[model samples]
Target: MSSNIQIHDIVITEQLSDRSYRNRNADLEKQAFQQLAKQSSYGAQAILNALCDLTLSLCDADSSGVSLLQVVDGEDGFTWNAMAGSMASYVGGRAPRHHSPCGYCLERGAAQLYSYPERFFEWMRLVGKPIVEGMVIPLYGKDKNAIGTIWMISHRDGHQFDRYDLQIISIFANHASAALRMQELY
Candidate 1:
């Protein structure tokens, strides 16, 4: 008896894409909600402050801040409402509505990280130094439209953001959006 073997061609494909951010911490989520409930009673600004403080700790970034859409002298822009950590120096800084990192995040309706975003902004650095690394999450208001963004920043050279950081900051963004919507009501 004779046996025959057959060989077939094999094809392989390689694709590279950015990593998706997804982190779910039950305890953290519960804690965040509880805090958001309390802060909501005070106002959106208070909630933003809480979120900024939490973002700094959650992402372990050098700094964290919240920017809200604003109109100043017939000009549209973003303004720092809450700031923590190293970037707190610019708590009241303003940036042009367009061509700003916050605008980018809002337009994309996503979370992202970048380095030295202030270089491309016309109104950034109104109070503090240029950012080294930044994480931005868009905030949607009651209308479900992007009103601004909440972000985390790192001034150090070696601190790079990862998927985990993005996911955690996203959680904060969710809560911030709700709070902002509540603020809009009052």
Candidate 2:
């Protein structure tokens, strides 16, 4: 064979564009929420587990956690019910009801997003640990009282959450608030 090389021109066509990909993902997310909405709350524990799983799935977060604070009669502060997380290790024990970002969110009655790593330094200072990024959405009951919050931490190297993620998680938080209220009532 002759010692010669031939090069062929190549043309790349963009078929599945960004818009189509986003639409597909949105459709899938909607379907997932619909399924979660159908799950019946057989018991309190079952309901909490379902809500945690749904919130985690909807937000596409690596770990999902719920921290509930209830005002105890005659107490100067609130009490933490269950501080649960998808990663059991992260929730080794109960979280304090004060001096934490999640508590700040509860007190402020607003959803807060911590995109920068340094924002968690205070928490690190307290626990001697570090968190990469997180989002916290306050849960409110039908009375609109700030009762609890849903916290999510992203996986290492995962993309930081955006507005869309916040919106989706807000919806999940709304449902979670209702569930928490129902549990408290009955």
Error of 1 at 114 (Å): 1.0
lDDT of 2 by residue, 36-110 (tens): 465536644455456667656665666666666644554333333333344635442344456455665676677
Report the lDDT tens digits of candidate 1 across residue range 1-186.
012311111000010025444466778767867787788789877888889878776777788888889998898999888899876777887877676777777776676566566555534555466666777788877667777888877777766666777666676687778767666731
> Best candidate, TM-score-wise?
1
User: TM-score for model 2?
Assistant: 0.67
Number of clashing residue pairs, candidate 1 = 0
For all candidates, the clash counts are 0, 0
